[model samples]
Target: MTTFDKYPTVIVSENEKDVWEGSKHIVKQLKTVALDHNLIAIECYPGIDVKKLYHDVIQPLNADETIYAADLFYNNHTITEMIESNLTEDDVFGTFSPHSLEEFLDDKKVKAVKEKLKSNQKKNIIIYGMGASLFSNESLLIYVDIARWEIQQRLQRGMPNWRTNNQDEQISRKMKRSYFFEWPLADRLKKALLNQVDFWIDGNDIENLKLISKEKYLQGLSQVVSQPFRLVPFFAPGVWGGEWMREKFDLDKDEVNFAWSFNGVPAENSIHLQYGDCKIEIPANNVVFYYPTELLGNKVYGRFGREFPIRFNFLDTIKGQNLSLQVHPTTEYAHEEFGAHYTQDESYYILHAEEDAIVYLGLKENIENEEMIKELEEAEVGNKDFDDEKFINRMRIKKHDHYSIPGGTIHSQGKNSVVLEISSTPNIYTFKLWDWGRVDLDGKPRPIHLHHGLESIQWTRDENWVKEHLSSPNQLIAEGEGWYEEKTGLHELEFIETRRHWFSTIVYHETHDSVNVLNLVEGEEAIVESINGEFEPFVVHYAETFIIPEHIKEYSIRPHGPSEGKTIATIKAFVRV
Candidate 1:
């Protein structure tokens, strides 16, 4: 029998009510099984005496927990020796201080961690009980990209003995530097403790995140808002722009702006061509002046791009029209052909859809690959027939049904479909497959680029194509575990998956790991607690997402809101294995 199947680790708890009850229980259940190797944690009140229970046998688990553990994996003996003396001794620091997670600038202690959680305004949770686990003693941990850089700097100065695990296992050197170079600087308090010497984290990165459009920002205001409007109780006109102009954009701009108004354009307003809802006005030019050019560069395209925890396209269906059946290029696809930094792999979580609304997935079964090829190749002329649509197969899809679209997959939305299109932040690259043979008053076939679409198509097809998975059948609210792993879609070029939990959960990790993009799927009332306070117990609304860095572990979350509140969804996107 395998170690886990044989010697299951055991979890013990003293303060049963310590909010992380689910995680606490799982830890206990692990002990009964036979496991040769694994990390384990156990806590019971301030001093319950685990020695008496496990004293009969030598605990073989890799992890152990107590009231006074200073690195159980590296320093368990210290905790054991102290426990023999007294329960009220130095052990308290090991069991209660939040410092065990990270050294806080305020105070690297458990009580401080608790205080931060209690006062956290983001709407996280309170950790009343202590929980610990020694799991994953054997894990390959690699810090990559910016997060990796920060860890490197800290390790270089703070601890001298630290060294690389395997110098040769390098992450792809070409992720095309992300705006992580623009992450907000750590608070003044944290800066003091980290003491990153001469750590010039630049001053202008903030500009990239500044909200730069008001007219374009209000693209969908007509729906959630009323006409002949007053921006008071009806709709509190949200300032559409970033708050950290220089820090977000790293543009070094003093301020950012995105305010514009439009009536009509004189066809020749500017040099660049204008499309639906986009143009430079004239006569009544009435520039909704987004003042700063740094802000203007992005505003020119309106708020179609964003950064941070994530960047996505927010579609407001004030005017609904079937976007040409199209496919997006994956990050890899972008890099291979056009070269893109942001990812194009995407999925649609229906925010709001008409009852009878429909969405087209891919070709239905029985359509031969050669037929698909022939259809695309011989499609200059058209008539009204299913065969005439030479694009995505139109089908009715409604609320709550998630549509997973990997790159190179032919798909599109039909009439009356408004969705939160969550995907990579590249904000560029969409290959148009086909558009209904309709044109604007100009009578032009909108626009077609089959060359680009062909490059984006995933040739491989499974018998069961267009699989729309239903989310939360029983609302299997995770009691407490590392994470719920779900593999959703597969692509010849890429694959997609999601790791989510309602209540905050503890996910143990080893040194080598992967950074996951986390998008909040539901329940605006939830908080994700972490070792350091970067992820405070805060509230998140629908369509929101976050990133979980690799290596950090033991963070837990609790649902807010009056109901049995918890994080609704933390969808993850990763390269397929």
Candidate 2:
């Protein structure tokens, strides 16, 4: 059948099983759909309790056994058939990595299941799992979406703590494993299947699960494609978590504290597409893949393909402790060592700060390479504290201050500060040099990457050099009756650039060849609208990051309040020539 002919079929697919609604509700939904046709519901799940699902869902729904259960179909081949054993680090880190579901397509066991779905001669068949929806043609697809944070909360509440017995240990283990180790691969598989879906359900909303249609979904995408878009922020806890974001943002009080918010790192965050009165959430990377040029423009598409090259996130340490001293690899080193396409060149934009706020940046002026290395080595192996002031320079900062951090620079956020980190898109690959002789909540010494830090640190970034170059000196670039723009000299190293705008009236701007990453750092709220009446206007609030797509050639921003004459300050970043 042609692609256009396949739009009518509706396939309900979930990224992961809902914590509240198990197979019982899903199977009941399937059975209700099966009443008028010869229907079969295939449960294509592994690493799960299939027998429990059968007793709980199938037996209750299937009175005459007309709705056949294909649960054991995956047993045709072992799990080993889906992945290569004893993979080396180099092999795993290489480019051209395929998602886990992509590997299943080649296995003969999957082929057998596909043939069974075809040969059953049923007018309607429901295949439900990771890749189950991919087997059929002319079917509408449904994706059930959930955030990684919500999944952890559900797991902690119900599931057995397999990794640890200690509460702190379990939380730490869950954060580390869930975010970096396990979910990345699983998310890759989910993203691979997202484009094929016709509807999406917010799995977190068990009471009134919003079912979004493909037409409405795509229509929402089109509206936001060339306009300012923001993703649903995902939060996580840290040992140095503070009360600022937890109280100011009104987050879940159950969390230890809100430490980080994944604002616009597309690979690690998802966007919510508004559909009439409902909303659908999909991986932010899907938008880049679906419309690369529209989101990233022609120049970016030609250079980076579908990769969104910038990330905006928050690091809150107000009334908390200092972050670990860390360094990221240079672009050349990242490509050669980890096979990464880009390096993380970051900057700290202090959104709010207490009286004693200070940032650890670069090394002391007279420190030699050997002394620094020896200090790091001693700290890593013996949990010994370095003479922080003798080696590391602590620069005092206040709200609205910007600190540049190119790759290879040693830096960390200090206590009593809430920083908006603007950087390149590379998320992982930090080499922690020290954690200030402190142990994690589990009473274990946190990891210190001595070797990698030694290799990546650019020793030239001394105290004087840092003050001269990394310190942002804002300069006025343009001004009008009630609006003005200032160029914030963040860095020119990674093709990423930033500017600040203070405007009381509507100020016009254009995205010439790059997408715009923006936040209302010093205002209550603001509205973004197209200059030529093309796309609809959108509102952004304080400390919230939003994007203006490359397709939005011209747009304007105005302060959003009681229409008085209060100035609004916004920070905007983008790729530059």
lDDT of every predicted structure (CA atoms): 0.33, 0.67
Candidate 2 local distance difference test against the native: 0.67
**474-499 per-residue lDDT for model 2 (tens digits):** 97888998999998857767578888
Where does candidate 1 stray beyond 4 Å?
1-311, 316-319, 329-336, 339-343, 368-391, 394-396, 425-427, 439-445, 459-463, 468-496, 504-512, 531-536, 548-554, 562-567, 574-577
Error of 1 at 529 (Å): 2.0
Q: For residues 196-232, what per-residue lDDT tens digits would candidate 1 score against the true structure?
A: 1111111111111111122332221211111110010
The residue pairs found clashing in candidate 2 are: 6-138, 9-139, 9-140, 10-140, 11-140
415: Cα error in model 1, Å: 3.1
RMSD of each: 26.1, 7.7
Q: How many residue pairs clash per model?
A: 76, 5
- Score candidate 2 by TM-score against the native: 0.80
